[model samples]
Target: MSEEIKVQLTATPGEKPDSQKLGFGKYFTDHMFVMDYHKDKGWHDPRIVPYAPIVMDPAAMVFHYGQAVFEGMKAYLTDSGKVLLFRPDQNMQRLNCSNDRLGIPEIDGDFVIHAIKTLIEIDKSWIPTEKGTSLYIRPFIIATEPCLGVRSSYTYQLIVILSPVGAYYSGGLEPVKINVESDYTRAVRGGIGFAKAAGNYAASIKAQENAKKDGFSQVLWLDAIEKKYIEEVGSMNIFFKIGGKVITPAINGSILKGVTRSSVIALLQEWGVPVEERKLSIDEIFEASQQGLLEEVFGTGTAAVISPVGELHWKEHTMKINEGKIGELSQKLYDTITGLQSGNLPDTRNWTITF
Candidate 1:
């Protein structure tokens, strides 16, 4: 039997309703899960505590050097009134992978799973059941040792927080407009891009903000060295369909190995939708758009199962894909993935874990 971890809960007396309606990481739940790790004691003092501010040293490694890693996932409520997690073990595994890369201490996967389950049980009421709405779970680790050095800290804190989110797109699943960043780079060879580290995101926020300023939703990042081949979109893995073939950038050292990206490839292969994983160049995609062969482009991640890319703006040149509408394959992919996640379809892979 697993050890029973204790949590001290304090409820927020009166909180207003979540009215933002926009669903990309907004309103946070009342409570959060936290655990600490030290050199001698290892991981201890695990608890599900109230969501509040945490005090940290100004010179903490995470604050200065950005030695932090995080994972994104969701808890879904099915039509049968059961709360379930979709492929949580995969997320735990990825978390460990990220920890290894970020020089953070590793926690047992089963222990982390138990902690998450406990936290969800306590905050189950916060999960939204509306369509395209669920509880977004964020698990992250931060270096907390007080020091001014650049090396990894001997102390760390792991926390999991919940947020109730609505749909990712504001206009109801409309395709997104992307800006191709030719100058800024998201990741590079031998970099921490594959890991869900904080620095990777901090480095891209400026580029993303610039894209948003130019009337685009996100930045479609490219390779760091050459800035030619496509890497990924902001916070999501990208996919493109042309000539009836689905093509996604291969998992090089620079690109994140997204769970949704892998699942999409598997499902497409099962459905016999010719799929290819290779280095997809931006120039090739532009040419394909000119020839009217680019059928669709989309991003896959935990936040948005599949966010369609309707247009790309590169170097003052605009290329519209799928005529600024969601493609058939994009719809099918979304339906299939969501069906599996929501228990509406047969989960042949046993991806769902009921609570």
Candidate 2:
């Protein structure tokens, strides 16, 4: 049996129904889970408190140097009135991986899982039941020690917050147009790119904004050293299909090891799709597109699940993939993954943990 954690809830006053109209991450729940760690005391004083503003000193390490990491996952409400978490253990493991890279102390996986379950139980009503809607959970750790020096902090804070989100594709499952960023690099070898650190995302906002301004939805980043191989899209891991085989870039030191990406590879392999985890070059994909052999291209992450890529722009040249429409494989992968998540399909991989 899991020990129940205490919570102090304070509901938000005059909440709006407009959240349904706006999509995900626009609205937050009334409460949040928090825990603190110290060099001498370790993690202590865990609690679920009202969602409120946090005060930090100007010299806080997170403010000065941006030493923070975060994970994105979801909680689903099934038709049977049961709540489920999709592969939370994997997220916990990944969080530790990020912590190790950031020089933050590792946390016990079981404790973190228990904390999440407790928090969700206290805020169950905040979860939406509409199709393509779920509670988005963000778990993050940040260095909070108040100091001006450029080093890791001795004090750390971890928090979990929930947001009710609608479908990522409001206009339906339409594919996206992505611009290949050959000039700017999102991550480099021997860098903190593999971790879910704040700096990695901070460095990407400008590029993403530029891409959006140019009528592209996202930027597909290439390797830093050679700027040849494909790495990932803005916040998701990318996948390509050529000649009926699924190929994604290998998990080099620079690429983030997304849970959704790993799960997709596992699901595809189980369905007899030849999945390759190796270096995939932009040149190869462009050649395949020119030869009319590129069948599909999509990105995977917790936020969008699997977003199809309709077009690719590389260095003043643009190529349309699958005639600028969603591919069959993309739809199949989305349906299968969403089905399993929504409890409409069999939980073959035992990916869901019920509450």
Candidate 2: where are CA atoms >4 Å away?
Answer: 1-4, 11-16
Give the number of the best model, judged by TM-score: 2
Best by lDDT: 2
Residue 164 C-alpha lDDT in model 1: 82
Q: Tens-digit lDDT track for model 1 on 160-254? A: 99888886765567898999998789889898989989999889999999888989999999998888999999889999998999999999989
- Roughly what TM-score does model 2 have, to 2 decimal places? 0.97
lDDT value, residue 277 of candidate 1:
98
Candidate 2: worst-modelled 10 consecutive residues by lDDT: 11-20
Worst 10 residues of 1 by lDDT: 13-22
TM-scores of all predicted structures: 0.96, 0.97
